[model samples]
Target: MENSLNTLHTIAFTHRNLPVSEIGNLHIDPNDQKERLTAFQSAMNLEELMFLSTCNRVEFLFVTEDIVDHRFLHEFFNALYPKLSETQRKLFADSAEDYTGIHAVEHLFSVASSVESMVVGEREIITQVRNAFEDCRKMQLTGDTIRLVMRHTIETAKKVYTETNIARRPVSVVSLAYHKLRDLNVPLDSRILIIGAGVTNTNMSRFLRKHGFEQFHVFNRTFEKAEKLANDLNGTAHKLSDLNTFDQGFDVIITCTGAEKHIITKEIYQQLLQGETDRKIVIDIAIPQDLSPEIIAENNVTHISVEVLQEISNANLKERSKEIQHVEQIIKEALYEFDHNHKSRMVELAMRSVPEKVKEIRSNAVENVFHNELASMDSESREVVEKIMGYMEKKYMSMPMLMAKEILLKKR
Candidate 1:
């Protein structure tokens, strides 16, 4: 059975301890995707494979019968991010796990539920997992197990969202910013500055607008991208160099940039303070952190980092206790179905081996009967003996075949 179904290994590497500077450098280069795929194809006998590359993490999930050596996985990682040193490699590689059957199903469901996300219940992760599944489909790399697992995970996530209030309020960094802004008693008419024109920033801008924030200023390292986002949102755009021009115009600053280091330092916040008409709120959503904690500790300023928001988000999640219970029920149901299917597949593969064994036994029995006939029987008697032996072989095997069928039926 072990030889038939294959062992499963799931490997994930993320920017857990890596500096923000290194994360920006590790951004997925579209041109390199094909090369990375090629390297994976060469390294393992993959029965199923999915590669998920996002701003927060890059993970590879694979299933295979062949025993995968660490060297192959190491090579694949090095190829994807050559900048990683031995220390970085160790940090990233520490999260690998091997799961078979039921454990794998549970793990996948947990991931879809955002239980494994850096920010729990972040809805963006569900979309990310869906996109990763689509990519796997595009590569023609998925099989029955991968497809079933993904389908179950997606369904479980939907159930979690619909059944739980985990997603009821704003839990994403952008939404959390809106919540924090409101909590800080910042008026809806207060001008807000959103730094970075990437997806996260764009989403944050939309969220702010949805909450009736009319005054917005967007800045990016690339002026054109920022301008495009600003135009769409009917806000103003500025380059990083022009950030000082706005001074105290912004009452709330929300930053989600790919900058390697702190874009908002003590000096910049001090300048804002110098021109302040009132207190200001700052939310840093970037992974490595867009705002330094030291700057946040200053007086007359309110700052919220991603880690702080995560705690708030978790507290909010706990408030939805009934919904979480419902989500747990959904996950259990989904896991049961997934595990049944996985075990059924293994049983089917095992049953396939039965036919060859039966045929070998039949051939050996026929050979012995023929040899005995040649030594002691006439042509007519030989024919009769052969017929009898064939009947007995079939009759004897039929019981085992029926038992296998009954086992499958009971599983169903």
Candidate 2:
């Protein structure tokens, strides 16, 4: 039987210092898809492989029988990011081998369960993982081990949500934005400006409206999308070209655009600062950052990056510590069941070989019976003998099949 206990290798890289809020600034070119696929093909002898690229992080997940060496990972990363310099190469080394065996399994579970997420229990990550799995399926790169593990991970996450309060409080980017605003003593009615019309932006807009932020403005590269979101939220839609125009009017500015470079540069900050009094809170949720860190350091400007939001997320994690113990227990139990069931399937495959052996024996017995009856038996007698042989063969194989079924049922 093939070994079902395949090792999982996962590598994740996110913004260095930004909080979870600023993760939206991270960017990857669509052209990198081929490079990533090729890299995965080269990196490991994987039974299954998946790559998840998001604004904040790039992660690769692999299921393989044997451990992979760093050379493959090195070449893979190099191929994926041909633009990476020597310094960046060192910074993004594959850390998978370091967490082999149990640690690796736990790490994967943690990620799938959202324990390692920037925002703990954020539901979007599970969807992202599923999408990655689907991509692997499209590439014909997945097998039973990967499929089972991913399915288990997803199921465990759902169980955690149902069995805990993790999702009840809503610890997503939108919720975190609202929390930050409240923490800064910003009034609920404060004029807020949200840039971008993507998932994160839409969520932020919805949260703002729910929390009674009456005055709002939205801007996106796509005017139609921005207008649609604004209309849904009953806010004004500003053209991306007019972004600089309202810089000073908003008390809270949240930008989560897909722009590769800084959208709100020093010039824009300077303009916002001229009329702004006190601290104007700006949250750059984009990976490359919509606002420059240098400008953020200026007086009267309070800038929060994705890394900072990660810290805030960490604090929020404390609130759910009670639930962690429960979720961990559930995950462990599920993992054990999954492993056991996988082993049982292997055993069933092994037992299936018994049926072929039984058939071979039955064929020999039937031949011997024919040899003895050839002189005395008629055609009807020969037909009856064949029927009896078939019945006897089924009876002989039944015990082995039943035993295999029993083992499978026991594991389940």
By TM-score, who's the top model here? 2
For residue 337, what is the lDDT in candidate 1?
73
Residue lDDT tens for model 1, 1-412: 4333345556654435443334444445444555667566556567777776555565666777666556655765676667678876665555444455566667667777866555567788788889888877777766667776788789889888777776665376667767777787778788778888877789878877877878888888889989998887788989976765556556788887766567887777666566564666787777556776677566456777666665665566565554656667788888777666666666665566666677787777657845674567787987887688678767655666567656755755
Query: What C-alpha RMSD separates each model from the true structure?
Result: 7.8, 5.0
Q: TM-score for candidate 2, please give it.
A: 0.75
Lowest-sum lDDT 10-residue window in model 1 = 15-24
Q: What lDDT would candidate 1 get against the real structure? A: 0.69
**lDDT, candidate 1, residue 112?**
77
Query: Which segments of model 2 are wrong by more than 4 Å?
Result: 1-4, 13-35, 42-45, 53-57, 94-105, 119-124, 135-141, 165-170, 185-191, 221-228, 236-251, 258-260, 267-279, 298-300, 347-379, 382-412
Overall lDDT per candidate, in order of appearance = 0.69, 0.70
Error of 2 at 211 (Å): 1.6
Q: In model 1, what lDDT does residue 378 have?
A: 81
